[model samples]
Target: MRSEHDPGAFLDRDGVINVDIGYPHRPEDFRFIEGAPEAIRQLNRHGYKVIVVTNQSGVARGLFDEAAVEHFHNHMCAELARHDAFIDAIYMCPYHPDGQVERYRADHPDRKPGPGMILRAQKDYHIDLSRSFMIGDKESDMKAAQAAGVPGYLFKGGNLVNLIELILKQIGRPLER
Candidate 1:
């Protein structure tokens, strides 16, 4: 039941789009990777749905709150809007098994290495996992993508635009201007 318009690019927030400076929930601390905005804009131009799938254990660890995370997301979206790029949606896991917060102490399916967030996105947005891919910096990200049946690419930290271009080429879909 795959639709022709269901292709998507699932991106990990920290370490992919922004610098992983450890639980960055403040707009002041958010730093966009070089070319990250352009990469997303290219995806937009190509009619691909750009979704952010992230793990924000900071909430569980008591470093931040869910509201703060949402605020940061809003800031991120606004920043991307400046470059005419947009994220279709954002999914995050605020739970961790060893969380300091009792409410968020349990393991959640939405956490990385689990497929809940991806599955939820597929259901909500009608994404085609076969036609989609993920970019992340951790093995847990790969595991999550695998669980969701989506191809995952590892980013060893660099210019996002270049990495995206290389990924597209490897997938036989060279980015075109």
Candidate 2:
């Protein structure tokens, strides 16, 4: 079915796909969630354009540089590629409310809960919000999805298989497995 609305879903990077260890900018620091690749592969197989919107306050805090973040993404994409899943686009907000760097400081509209990233994806990809859903581990993901008019799924602590099963059911397609 072609959805004239909500053409794709936006995802969070850290806690959603990888283990959130403050700010993971190194390839060695990257750890994929048990079923993240498969889950994303499922989304791709189902024809969902998986996009990632992330908040990298570490850049503002001087914990890491933008190049490190970009490199991190490149490594991440390579890792996911092994599973035949790739994110459509990745939007990151490196600024923080209080940052060491002048440019990195201050609130930015692209931050989660702000809807900037989601809206940009919508405008760029022509997504239908009501038809797409975001799966994330933070409340900010919920707020962002809500603000962008897309459904949100909070990833509470649980088994990976169960989580995917739940998401499928919530989206109205029970996993055949």
Candidate 3:
């Protein structure tokens, strides 16, 4: 049974929100995909809680630390704020079974294809999963959304605002102020 809680727009960070440049942790490397900010702003105006779910295995691989990831996210947020767009929350998985870091060496449920992050977000935000959807660039992200019982959309790269508009139309969700 679905609750009256608001629907959420779950987004993948890399490839979807920003250009995926391998293990991007530096602020200078952070670049938003075309129309990503406006896409997020559209979601905001449509009454969807924009949430970012990403896998930052770079931390586990020793390429960067969690602090670096946080700093990168902060930079993204700051840039998005300039367009009057904001993400409600962000969940990242730093664990990988083949990680070089001992503490992060594990196949964590929060990792994509596991759905732990989305499930946790659902609980924390009281989101109605039935009405929620995820946009990602990988099949693992689709699997995670399926596992969490939410619809998923695959982004193959292009203008994100166009994708968001199509998704809204497909879902029959009217744009609101």
Candidate 4:
């Protein structure tokens, strides 16, 4: 693994940036967690792109389609911009083996724990995963980061502040007051 001084780190979406509302598909349900926007802003200030990797199994459940998910993401971006934070990209995997439709059936590589989305981002944006960090709220998130060769932070249920301190320590950079 590379040192934390690197700039091109990545992050996950669902529970990292916004509270996971269980396959959130509605714009009204996208709640930004406390300190999340600030944390993202901090990373952005340090030259990190702040990409969002999410696994939307809702697509498989046929609750909401990809278009709806994109709409939700767009709204999220707009809200984040209000806090002077913006995501570099929002990559999602809407496929699930137990989902609906002929096409949605089966495991997808882009799904969390598979690292497909992160890999694609690395290839498309020349990201350095070895030096990057990922913040997530689930074991899948950690697994995905591991598969992508990046360190992961399991954003505990509500330990947003703890995560901030951890990142600051890992980066060996003091947080701005």
lDDT tens string, model 3, 1-177?
Answer: 535688899999999999998988999999999999999999999988899999999999999999999999999999999999999999999999999999999999999999999999989998878778999999999999999998999999999999899989988574477
Q: lDDT for model 1, please.
A: 0.89
* Candidate that scores best on TM-score: 3
True-vs-predicted CA distance for residue 164, candidate 3, Å: 0.5
What clash count does candidate 4 reach?
0
Per-prediction TM-score to the true structure, in the order listed: 0.94, 0.90, 0.96, 0.89
Q: Model 2, stretches more than 4 Å misplaced? A: 1-6, 173-177
Clashing pairs in 2: 5-128, 6-128, 6-129, 7-128
Q: Of 1 and 4, which scores higher on TM-score?
A: 1
Write the residue-wise lDDT of candidate 4 on 1-177 in tens digits.
Answer: 443333455777777778877888899999988787888787777667578888888888889899999999999989989989878887888889898766787799999899999888887777766557788888988899899888887877664656866786776442232
C-alpha lDDT score of every prediction, in listed order: 0.89, 0.82, 0.93, 0.79
- List the candidate numbers ranked by lDDT, top first: 3, 1, 2, 4
Task: Give the root-mean-square deviation of each candidate in angstroms.
Answer: 2.0, 2.6, 1.6, 3.1
In model 3, where do residues sit more than 4 Å from their true spots?
1-3
Clashing pairs in 1: none
Task: Give the lowest summed-lDDT range of ten residues in model 1.
Answer: 168-177
**Candidate 4: RMSD to truth:** 3.1
For model 1, residues 1-177, the per-residue Cα lDDT tens digits are 435556789999999988889899999999998889999998887667799999999999999999999999999999999999999999999999999999999889999999899889988998867778999999999999999999999989778898888867776452344
Q: On a 0 to 1 TM-score scale, where does candidate 3 land against the true structure?
A: 0.96
